[model samples]
Target: MTQQPTPDAPTVLLVDDEAALADSLALWLERRYRVRVAYSGREALQTFDESVDLVFLDHNLPGLSGESVLEELSRRVDPSSFAVVMLSAAPGDELADLPVDAVLTKPVTKRDVFDAADRFVGDAPEAKLD
Candidate 1:
């Protein structure tokens, strides 16, 4: 959504029921990555593809819970294809068993976002398709 991304740059799919937070994160991440925003689980599913390198997924949503979304994603794609950072207002115990690369408690800070990005979606250039 941030212009066409540079091919080597990473892509981040940010999913949250909170439009403000989702948009704000997209604005911040756009400087470094191609960012896609989805305010609902259905949209997240529709927007995601193999090109996405990272995901910032919110655990609690109205129509489709993040848990459900994760389940669907696992079923739909290879688990190793992308990194998922699950976000939630709920306690960490609530998310301990989920199949995500990482988990962040919400009211997440800029540090939290970048820390995950730094760890999972670092500076490596994506492999170019011929």
Candidate 2:
């Protein structure tokens, strides 16, 4: 059996090559969860840490492929430590072979994203104030 991490506000790593889209999604997620953004797979890998409770990875990325990033992450993090959600604008057979927790199609709504985050992270925390 896989050991689960202690429940907490989810820390999501959002990886996308599109800077504008990535920023928009990051902003949206930041309102609820701890959000991290990476413009490429290499950057995503660099930003990855044990704190990341879930991942939203874009299928098509420049430089290293998202699959490669996932493979590397699988090797570094415990299988149960985090969940991987593959996001793609286009469908492909290659994604079927990945060991991700879930796959979501692009043009994703805020609710859909949050729902996925909640599924991985559990309940949301009370908003923090300055």
Candidate 3:
């Protein structure tokens, strides 16, 4: 099972074949949102659920490509319910055929992740600095 989200914070699923990257993103993201890390497409499919408010999908995975996973997700639920951001080195226009809220280029930075979170799910309560 994925990490359970607390009542207040939104859940974020980070799917990437790169273990280091996924872990790094999860570590930083956990300060705000409830974070789940899936190292493969199969794991991502399993980890995702209704609770997820945002998904950061890496396009070029070793097994089930992000496009395929997105297709399956689209079939399982309404696309508009949760936000999907496809991460890829390819140009955004090339991915126009894909159903995604936004396309972020790799190598994504902490700022990119934070921006996406804010844009999609709004700020997590803990993200605010007094």
Q: Which candidate has the highest lDDT of all?
A: 3
Best by the TM-score measure: 3
Q: How many Å off is the CA of 59 in candidate 3?
A: 0.5
How does candidate 2 fare on TM-score? 0.88
Which residue pairs in candidate 3 collide? none
Query: 1 or 3, which is superior by lDDT?
Result: 3
**Per-residue lDDT of candidate 2, residues 1-130 (tens digit):** 3223233567889999988878888888776677899999999999999999889999889789988998899899886899999999986888888888888898888888888888887766855553
- Predicted candidate 3, C-alpha RMSD: 4.1
Point out where model 3 deviates above 4 Å.
1-6, 127-130
The weakest ten consecutive residues by lDDT in model 1 span 121-130
Model 2 regions lying over 4 Å from their true place: 1-8
For the record, the alpha-carbon RMSD of candidate 1 to the native fold, in angstroms, is 4.3
- List where candidate 1 sits over 4 angstroms from the true fold: 1-5, 124-130
Question: In lDDT terms, how accurate is model 1?
Answer: 0.86
